[model samples]
Target chain A: MTAAATAAGAAPRRSARRRLALVLEPYLYTVPSVFLIALIMLVPLAVGLSYAFRDLVLLDPDSGGFVGLDNFRTLAADAAFWNALGNTVTWTVSSVVLQFGLGLVLALLLDVPFRGRGLVQALVFLPWAVPSFLSGLDWAWLFNPVVGPLPHWFVALGLMTTPDNLLSSPDHAIWGPIAANVWWGVPFFAITLLAALQSIPPDLYEAAAMDGAGAVRRFRAITLPFLAPTIAITIMLRTVWIANFADLIVVMTRGGPADSTQILSSYIFTQAFQRLDFGYASAVAAVLLVLLLAYAAVLVTLRQTFLARR
Target chain B: MRAHVLRRRLFRVLHAGLLACFLVFALFPLFWLLKVSVTPNDLLYSEGVRLWPSRITFDHYASVIAHTEFPLFFRNSAIVSSSTALLSTLVASGAGYGFSRFAFRGRAAIVGLMLVSQMFPLVMIVAPIFRLLSPLGLTDSLTGLVVVYTAFNVPFATFLMQSFFDGIPRDLEEAAMIDGAKRFQALRLVVLPLTLPGLAATLGFVFTAAWSELLFALMLNSSAAASTFPVGLLAFVSKFSVDFGQMMAAGVLALIPVCALFFVIQRYLVQGLTAGAVKG
Candidate 1:
């Protein structure tokens, strides 16, 4: 019964209670998660933000005083910071481009009907399950001059002058981590893209086939458009995520061979963990947060404008 | 007509070849890890880039099991991940169900809050989380890791569970309710059984995430006993002078559980994921 009936005194109070409960059900259902996230994530996030403006070193008891923007000032002039910013761009772009391109190819391949497709899908997607840190280490091992075949293959293919470890080369060192990242992350793109592909109506293809469209022509006319939105969003999300991702870099090179691979995130890690510079690390983190938010805003606006134009 | 047939045949060959390349690219490093893990010590250097070792031995695996702190780390990882998965799933399913079924007050606000959690650099929160947990004596314990991981995972897990819940018809519970069962009771009796695969998918995803987490595991747990597999594996890497075979064996061992969980859950992943806010 409606609240009107309850006011008319025809409905029992038990049914009224049930109605009230129904009204509150969503709150009751979601409150636990909201509470937990508030306590664990938001509280700590507040504390972390507080650290950005304060002088808080872990080992130093006397270092809890407020130091407004001092670390940010230091950051402005820091050469390592500048280098890391440049490297973050290079790393994020290369990793996303490689992973996305390769993943799309893989996804399209899987979308085709074939024998053992299920098993093959599972196998290809297996790399996504291998822990990021392990993939980093595994790829690092694969590039080791002594044991791995990659460097040997590189030499044989005439791509390298010697069978030397790629991790030690300052110029090409970033690619090592990027390659590993591509290996680990391609499955993520493939899975998402394949999901998108599966959702595409099959009869569209059948209809196009009836119209005498070639494979490439039909794909260009249909598949690409269907995948565009998925591609755009995935690229944006993965770009931000890859920029923040530092585990592979840290594990493989520790920002390596003279900080060649020190993206902003890994730089933050090194400052915080290795040097115990929490305040500075948090400063770097705050800057990164602002940068990411700005990036996200731009991407969202671009997507909006693009949609409007379409 | 014969030219068209030959072109199709050529394209088929090309596709097969490209797929083979992808398969090798995906699987080769894993195969190398396994090969190294099994190669006998004498043949390790002698093998030098060979696909298969002349001699195979389980000594590395045996040694890793018998003579190391890996078992303790493995156990700790399992405890933390499983606890995180269970707790996150329980809490997230409730939230997801609400989101899926209702359009109530503060729904948008709550969703925006969860999305905010996904936005920030989580490293920013590490120090603060450490400070918050340390005073409560939660640091260096598996429980600490579980709580943190559960919170970290809840956002994605909620979205995932919401998708799964969204897929299920609400009429199942409504029909039960019409027969005099409470809504919660109907949910338990009628709806819950249907969501088992969805629940399993969420559980396995969260488990895999928690198991592989390195940074928080490193920061929160100072003790060897509390360190998860990632931390232990990282520590093992520093001992490069020590047997390479044993290290790879530990890496292989670490890869096993998550891979198995993922293999089981992979089918559900796309469907469950696509149903929710996967676009964002």
Candidate 2:
């Protein structure tokens, strides 16, 4: 009734000026955001896209000339690009799988009635609250081979000999950041899934119990299906985050140990900022943009399907 | 009934044990941070494998503050983060409201473009951004960091704020308009009041993001005068030796503003501020 009344009363066509004002209202609210976004975001992006085609120097602006896919050609053969690409894939896959796995288990456990539940929830969520850089720094310290608690304990227990800096080893450097990423990222997955869990009706579980369904069977048949959409969205978001994250790498390894831990983002940083290769960096960025666009398309499709059923 | 009771008790015990183990795993790092920050430098290696240190001191904290450039870094970080948060929230709120309410030309494209902006790695844009800012004399300035952070943050922040605005009902504005209010006045009186929680959340989110951002800060600013806390922390690790005590102390101090900010605005952070603002 209120919707109908508001719709009829504010139709605005009663006066031409009022109608025009109504038409302009939405645009006015949007103008400031649109202007800032255009200037700071859109224009820079256009500039970047153009750079992909031009030979550009970071220090010398006047050096840029239309190169016509030269940057792309260079990146295609670059050994570092392939290596970084491989590392990025490995990093994203491992981190996402472990994070979701741990998060789902934690969420399931937290879903059950238990003592100190609130305290546990708060404690688990603490890592998420800490800044990512600080969390990375904290882990960097804990994984320090010289005086870190973890390595020290391992040495004393005869687990490993002497000082072994995880970040200094090619095989383990990436894992240090991966561990920190999981520590921080698990909470997001847990919270989102927990919210979804709370919304699942208890009657379904009761019905399952009455049918003598075991706990694993009930979870598989009842819980998993309902949680699929949330889980999918969580994975998509985390994949994008993990793929692009550079802070942890910068803090823990700085893409070091012979660039073993270098992912695409860090590689791009090195190319652009460290090497001052503006044109190449833009091309690399454009590649990342393409990958992300594909990811976003899948996400949109998933959201549509989920919403359609709802 | 007795058998059922026994099974239920067993399940409870299992749940308790699992959660307890996970909690310890999750919290061990934070506990270790505190433990190491207080452990004296000499005992750091000497007290190997011990759960608790035999002794603790505030000397690290005292040295970090009094002897280092941490205070300047803290001040610079404060200025940059707070400004970015305030500006981005204000900008995002306005944009979000427009997106939520208006069906203007190119609106969808604009939003899609913003999403595209978010996908590219910041590393890709760093050199171009630096080149773009250098001519404007923004390099090595705190204002440069603010501009960069605000640009990077505004899109996501706008999306977040738009979700909030979408939750607010259009009826409130219509009713106010019916009672003889201009559109801006109606928005100011009716809509803005309800957007407080959203505004607070956006501010807190962006502030924390800018506070810890390092790449742009490192690339854009070179001098200690303009360096933020993250960059300042890097200064503690010289070529010859890393002062773990001072570095950890600085890391601990950086948590203060973030913790205090979260403590103050956590009500908005946790609350589903959109509830009751819209109808299903």
Candidate 3:
């Protein structure tokens, strides 16, 4: 009787240990990633946010002093910052709109079953494989009149009075990078939208067609509603991405020709990378982060409200 | 009926035409790159706008390969990108497995943090990362690029892997565990084999991202010895702005690995993203 009671007591203790291990197993698997992200990305992000308040300059031993909004004060008065902010709006809006518009058209075209569709899809999406810097350079070379065909084509088409480098003109220089960005980013939108498009039930379209709906009518009734969610989420995410995208502009224009092509991201790059002014760059970055967060928040709330109504 | 037939025929023609336009637009720059690379220096400016050069030569390719720092840059890029891919995939698989198998405390919060990480402006951390890594003797090092790229890639890769794991049924591993196996062993033996494709897609995706990365590589590694291809190419552009043929040759070389990987993995990427869309 005494041995039996001892055995029963030990059974619960063993099971409890097993239960604890099971609970901890997930953490064991997940903790390394959490630890690394926190250490490498999150910690640096925090430090960067703090750098906005301090005077931090690269290679300057004496510059790490608490500045307490001094960077912000300077940024407020800075004409270049304001210009970049304006240009950022132009850049993000134009790029997102153009990419979405073209991508939707491409997706719609690809949706219809046709011969050699696979080959066509592969060919059209090829530009996305080009690296951003290379895309920028490629487009830049195209705009150069000396060796590129674009200027000659433009002149022949009467779109330009001369075979001049479009990249050198301050008034129209932003378009150079924008064109590159559109080329590189269109495939991303097309792929996502195409997936969403494919997911819609073919029966819905068939049923609508049988009810005497035309192509436009079917698209309006069935396709638009199904695509609305994906479109919203994609455009939101892409806006944030394009706004932060500096590589194309940096490589293509270097924010030159009177800083006309300098969006907020490139401006931040310029301040940090070229000027080595870490504090000011972080300040600009902090502002950009806040703006992006606000934009995202507004989008989320709009989505929530829209969903609730639906 | 006759009008309907003609309208359909017209639509088909228009569709084909539009597709052709898109194909040309998509390929023109790459074709131009190739064209310039093969065009002799004398012919580059003279027949710049020609549909095809009268004569083509591989002299630019030979020179870029034999004469420039491109080989070194390519090596550095290959090392950094591959290391980032391998390490990120490994870490992500663990987290992905965790997210897929267990619903535990803090899971939602962790997922949320990762999503937020995707949105945060990476440019913000450039300076602080520089500061942070400099002290650790990682600045101007290939190891530093690998670490940063791995961390940047892990969040997206984890989500990708989790989606893949979600597609797989839990019963496979459960059966293994029931047959006298530990959880990790089940993962290693059963789930890992199934997840090979997921691992490969993640590897390719991360590799492309790292290979294309220019900013951090440019900022962190200033020395030519440590420079990745993008930085080295940009430097070459500024230093030898007139050498269009050789520069285009180098550019073509940079395009090879990424374009090859992209064609292979793009379908998987699309599937992954679609799965993510439905779930999200």
Candidate 4:
């Protein structure tokens, strides 16, 4: 019996090593991708951090001097920085709110069965399929003072005497980009929320109806809880996208009409590429990174708290 | 009973009306794009808010195709977008599978790090990226644009693919393995076949992303030879006046490839979106 037990143990040990080998083999498949990611993403991240403290000029190609905190100090006093920051916050918050509100409303409306339902759903999702740059340009054309259909429609309808180029003014320029963003973003929220809406079992609604619950009451009791998780995740993703978005701004305004529509991302581009101040740009970027990290952390915490209660 | 019936009908009518309004609101821009594209340049401003132009002509499309650099821009965009899509999908699939199935020592850390990567604004890192790429003789090249786009897009693509993989069950692969197949064989035979919708979705998403990408293309490539369509569109905007008709014509033309690609891959996209919507 003892000898038999010893042989069994020895056999299992050999198989365990084989299992280890098997696991290692699966991991080896990921090596090429991991290496490339490290090279392109991870290394640049490290370089960015290091460059934030070093004065690197684009023209000279060899001029890099270590200047700790100077970039941050300069950025502190920079009026454009404050304006961009404010614009970025406004863009992110308003776009996110309108996106969620309109998306939720559309999702709710689509939740009910009606004629041409599939066609309506597809049409509502059209904006998402269009390219962001093209969308920006499209909006720019629509908002064009002379030839745009929007201002023309407004004037024809007696909303204004003359066509206003909204993108030309500081106050309205930021809203132009926001309007463009909202057009593109609402579809994602609608789709995601609609998915979440569909996942709630119909039986629950039937049961609520049997219990004499009305439409709004049933939604309050059953639908909202089930959709909360999806809503939270979608909002987090949209916030991140909006906060860092540059293409739309670049295409529409170029952070222009006197930098009124400049967000952090476009501002960083100007600092780095246009001004040729790599170090200062890096510092600004680093600050942006920290804020995003904080935002993500808060989102994760919120999600955790929400989940913990369940 | 009659009142209840009337209320139900009212609700139905309201729902349909609301959906119709939303649909029109959403699709108006696309409709206008098509409307303006076919409208002659002469009546662009003078037409004054007509739903359809007084007369339609294909002159702008003809001119854009024949008279401008539109074809070259389209070709360059196609090459860059398609290559980036294929290459990134391949890379992302491997990484995504690892993330979905494997339980390595640093798996959680790696996933977290990838999330962190998404948080950094691209503008923040554009300088360092340019600096790094300049030394490799990649700046102002199509290959450079592809590489940068692939790098920027892979993380999101990987996450997207990973979600797809996670939706697929593990039992199929285990069954294949039990049937005397090696792990890779099981993956190739059973898993890869099931992941086709995911692969197609990732390809389409990455392709569109790369095609429409302008900022990096603008900052990275200055020469006309390597310029993509979005960058090419910038040429229409000189210091003095913007060419609205030609730019709109070019924009309309640029939509064709994306529309065509989406049409081909629409099946996969629908499948991908609907796959994880409902529980099995």
Candidate 5:
């Protein structure tokens, strides 16, 4: 009777232990990644956010004390910061619209099966592999009237009065980086959209076609709806990314030709690195982060509502 | 009937025309880089607008390799990129499996945090990261770069891997577990082999990103001994603004590894991303 009672008690104890293990299993698996990210990324992020309120210049050893919104006050009156904010909007909007439009066209083109499609896809997507700095340099060289064919072609096409570099004109210099951005970014959209496109069942298109739908009608009815979610997410993510992208502009222009190409991101870099004003840089960055979060929140809400209605 | 045939042919022509336009747009910049890299120094200015040079030479490539610090930069980049890729993939795979298998508490919140992490302006953290790493002796070191890059890449890599894991059936690992293997062993013996392509895809994506990173590399590593290819090339550009041929050659060298990686993995990249896109 005592041996039977001990066996029964141990059964419950062992099963309870197993239940506890099950509860902890996922945390065990995820702890390493979460720990690393917390230590390296999130901690730095918090510290960086805190730095915005302090005078934390890189070289000034005496600059770590908190300044209580002085940086934001200074930023409010800074014309360069304001100009950069404007440029940031212009840069993000133009780049995203151009990339999305061209990428969508490329995706639709590749959707149809044809001979040599693979070769064409590989060739066209090659630009995405070129490092951004290289793309910047390559396009900068191409826009140079001294070496590249573009200025000459522009003159021949009657788009220019003379063969001159497009990157030297402050009014038009932003387009130079924007052009390079489109070239490099189109492949990303194409790849994502193509994947989404391919996932659509062929019979949906066939059914729509059989119901007296033309290409435009079928696309409006089926393709657009099917692609709506992917399009929304991709565009939202790409907008945020391109807003923060400064490598091309920095490399190609250094925000030069009268600070015309200085987006908020490059402005932040310039402030932190060139001027060593980390506090002000972080303030500007904090503003940018807030704007992006607001943008993302809006897009997510829109996507939700659109999906819900469907 | 003739009208229908004519309309179809017109559509075909329009499609091919657009494709050709894209091809030319995509290739023109690279072609120009190649053209300049090959043109001998004497003819660089004289044949500026020429589609092809009258003569081509390997002198630029030879000079960049033999005379510049590009080789050191290339080695550093390769080391940091590969290490980041391998490390991020390993960490992400574990997290990914957790996300895929378990519907535990706070799962949505964790995923939300990751998504928000991807949205922030990384420029904000540059100074903070420098300060954080400097005290730990990670500043001006390759190890510092690997650690930082791995953290930045882990979120996206985790998502990529989770989507891949979600594609896999749970029964395979369950069966292995039922046969007396531990869960980790079942993962190693059954699930991992099936996810080789996913691991490879994550590796390629992370490697390319780490290879292309310029900002942090410039900020953290000031010493030429630890500089990455992008920073090295930028320094070269400013120092030798006149050496177009040598600079283009260095640019070409930078392009090789990423292009090769992209070629191998673009197919799987599409597949992996497609899975995520549909699920979302």
Candidate 6:
């Protein structure tokens, strides 16, 4: 039928209908995805926003009534919320920078020819497949002074004066989750950067090497420029992602020995799960969503201006 | 010439040494997990910092499998992950084919919307999803988790599928159409088999993602019947507070399916990833 319609010797109306169907076909294919995403994601996002304006408790029968802005009002004065906001910034920056740095080094290393490269690549990237929750628990065990080696090693290296669970120290507790976050997250960046590295033409390096460029000089001139766009987008997306990643923090410290490791996402989890305070949790989640959107917008605009300048 | 050769030799050795250090750093925590899981309860603390256990035992694994509800959790997770993988892959491959084949109106709008979906803090929707699911008899159900995970996974999976579809020649499908096969028939007969690697990659990604999701599993399923491996492992953390061995054993089991899936899909993922990067 399609061939007949396209042959230009067939009925004009039939060909028009065929063209119309071709136009509609893409929408027909996309309908399921759009419908599912709208139903499961957007509708909930709208409902969740509405939830922030009302009193919503899971167990309380009398809590459905609107108490507009009350959750936000309480959040303003909540000390833990404020601390969590601060800790969130620290956590996001530290984890992103460390993960990117280590991942870049790994990607660069793997970009070259080496013996057993496949095996080394697989083993190095294995952490990315470990469930985040398990990664959290595993690291928590490693930091335990009793059954694990890390703290004892730390003491021996003089990083600590005595063997104590670093996860239990309020002054330094946030580092526990950050360490696990960096370790688990490094593989994600490495894989992405490696792919981006592979896409760069080899002659860019070869030509530079022929001109007597040293390793550091070649990286600064050839590699860094090529990786910049990927680095920007990856860093932006990962910042937002790591900010919302509360699992490691929640599992390792449960928001801590004294709520010291509490970040905004974990606080939201605690409220929604433990206290059943859906309204406050949704409110905090709303704040996080808004902040992330702002961050993403800024990044997009910056990249736009950057490309325009170039 | 001698100095340059010496420097080059040193560089090679340094590269190997640094790579080895990273390998150990990456594997050490997991190595400890396995070591702890196999260590006898008596030696768990006594050989606390040992590089290896004095003796090994599978008692922790046996207890976790025989006594605890981990087997049930594993079954639930398998059901959820597999179904999620199949459902998401089917829907996404369709969307991907559409994106790849058609230059239709509203394509940009649809792609933009998909990107927007990727931006939000998904935790914001946890409570609302719980509310939405419970009324429909979906809470504490494998189908509920499947539905939730399928939606979460479809956007990225669709992009992956689209890239795979893009890699295929349009002429192949056009030839099928000219040969009297319907477009759907052409996809099924000609294009589908060729995209098997991409489909495998999508399934593996979705399966691993659903396997590891914990928050919704914890919130939506209060009953033991619907608990996933992560949820069940957390329960053991509290129940067997003193038995690190058992907890690690359960943790190791949770890692198995995902790790296996990872190995299967990593190569396809490399290809899909490059295509995606180049396209978008």
Error of 5 at B147 (Å): 0.4
Write the number of the candidate with greater DockQ, choosing between 2 and 4.
4
Question: Which candidate wins on DockQ?
Answer: 5
Candidate 3 lDDT for residue B224: 87
Deviating ranges (above 4 Å) for candidate 1: A1-12, A305-310, B170-181, B240-242, B274-280
User: TM-score for model 3?
Assistant: 0.94
Question: Across residues B1-280, which tens digit of lDDT does each residue of candidate 5 receive?
Answer: 9999999999899999999999999998998998899999999888889899999999999999999889999999999999999999999999999999999997888787777777767888887788899999999999999999999999989988998898789999999999999999999999999898889989998999999999999989999999999999999999998889999999999999999998888878777766766665
After TM-score superposition, the amount by which residue A190's alpha carbon in candidate 6 deviates from its true location, in angstroms, is 0.9
Evaluate every candidate with DockQ and list the scores: 0.62, 0.42, 0.63, 0.48, 0.73, 0.65
List model 3 lDDT by residue over B105-166, tens digit each: 99998986776676666888977788789999999999999999998999989988987788
True contacts kept of 5: 0.71
Query: Which DockQ-derived CAPRI band holds candidate 5?
Result: medium
lDDT (tens digit, per residue) of candidate 3 on A72-152: 999999999999999999999999999999999898898889998877887788788888999999999999997799999
Query: Model 4, range A68-105, lDDT digits (tens) per residue?
Result: 88888988999989988998998899999999999999
Per-residue lDDT of model 1, residues A96-205, tens digit only: 99999999999999888889888888888899889899999899989997768999999999999989999999999999999999999999899878878887889999
Q: Using Cα atoms with residue i matched to residue i, what is each candidate's TM-score against the true structure?
A: 0.94, 0.87, 0.94, 0.92, 0.96, 0.94
Indicate the residue-level lDDT of B144 in model 2: 90
Query: Which candidate do you rate higher for TM-score, 2 or 6?
Result: 6
**Residue-by-residue lDDT tens digits, candidate 5, A50-127:** 989999888788998999999999999999999999999999999999999999999999999889988899889989
Model 3 RMSD in Å is 2.3
Q: Which parts of model 5 are misplaced by more than 4 Å? A: A1-10, B178-181
Candidate 1: residue A139 Cα off by (Å): 0.9
Per-residue alpha-carbon lDDT of candidate 1 for residues B106-131, written as tens digits (9 for 90 to 100):
98899878866776767788888988
- State the displacement of the C-alpha of residue A264, model 3, in Å, after optimal TM-score superposition: 0.8
What residue runs in model 6 are displaced by over 4 Å at the alpha carbon? A1-10, B166-186
lDDT of 6 by residue, B1-280 (tens): 9999999999899999889988998999999999999999898878899999999999999999999999999999999999999999999998999999988788888887787778766777987788788999999899999999999999989988997887789999999999999999999999999999999989998998898899889878989998999999988897777799999999999998898788777667666666555432
